[model samples]
Target: MATGKKAKNVGKGMKGKVKETTGKAVGNESMEMKGKAEQAAADAKQAGQKAKDTMKH
Candidate 1:
């Protein structure tokens, strides 16, 4: 089972993906780029957290 923090990060990443897709579908370039950036950041954060947790073991 995934921890609560991991689940939350995954949810956030999904939300970013939805925003990005919606923005692109609506032809809003700015919003689409923003969403994409947010998604990348969220992914990086999640990865970092996972690395940190692994080091604790």
Candidate 2:
């Protein structure tokens, strides 16, 4: 079973990818950057959560 934060991170990352694709299709640089940032943040958060889980074992 995945932890809550891990799941959330994954969901957020997926959402960001969708946004990024949409933005690119619409020629919106700002939205694309925002989506990229969101994906990065989600990745960072997921990595942090993984580290914490590892330390717990």
Candidate 3:
């Protein structure tokens, strides 16, 4: 049972992956770069949340 925020972040990361793959398939460098950045940001956010949760335990 994941929290809503965590689920959202995971969803965002998944969407970013799709965008990156689609961009690459279409040969759109800018879109691919943007997607990669978005994915990184989402992953960082998720990691931060996990750290926060661990500290509370």
Candidate 4:
């Protein structure tokens, strides 16, 4: 069973990827930039979750 935070972070990253791809297909620069930011945010969150989980063990 994965931690909720980890799962959510993974979902967010996946969603961001979809958004980025869709934006590229449609030539929407703003959407693409937003998706990139979302992905970066999700990555940061996942890193934080990993650090927290490590401290618990």
RMSD of each: 1.8, 1.5, 1.6, 1.6
Error of 2 at 51 (Å): 0.5
lDDT for model 3: 0.88
For each candidate, the alpha-carbon lDDT, in order, equals 0.85, 0.89, 0.88, 0.88
Over the stretch 1-57, how does candidate 2's per-residue lDDT look in tens digits?
Answer: 257777899999999998899999999998899899999999998888888878889
Off by over 4 Å in 2: none
Q: Relative to the unseen true structure, what is the C-alpha lDDT of residue 57 in candidate 1, on a scale of 0 to 100?
A: 86
How far residue 8's Cα lies from its native spot in candidate 3, in Å, is: 0.6
User: Number of clashes in every candidate structure?
Assistant: 0, 0, 0, 0
Model 4 lDDT tens row, 3-57: 7878899999988988998999999999898889899999999988888878888
Candidate 3, superposed: residue stretches over 4 Å from native: none
TM-score of 2: 0.90
**Model 1, range 1-57, lDDT digits (tens) per residue?**
248878888888888898899999999998888888878888988998988988888
**Residue 26 displacement in candidate 3 (angstroms):** 0.5
Arrange candidates, best TM-score first. Answer: 3, 2, 4, 1
- TM-score of each model, in listed order: 0.86, 0.90, 0.91, 0.88
Give the alpha carbon lDDT tens digit for every residue of 1-57 in model 3: 249988899888888898899899999998898889889998999999988888888
Better of 1 and 2 by lDDT: 2
Which ten-residue region of model 3 has the weakest summed lDDT? 1-10
Please give the range of 10 consecutive residues that has the lowest summed lDDT in model 4: 1-10
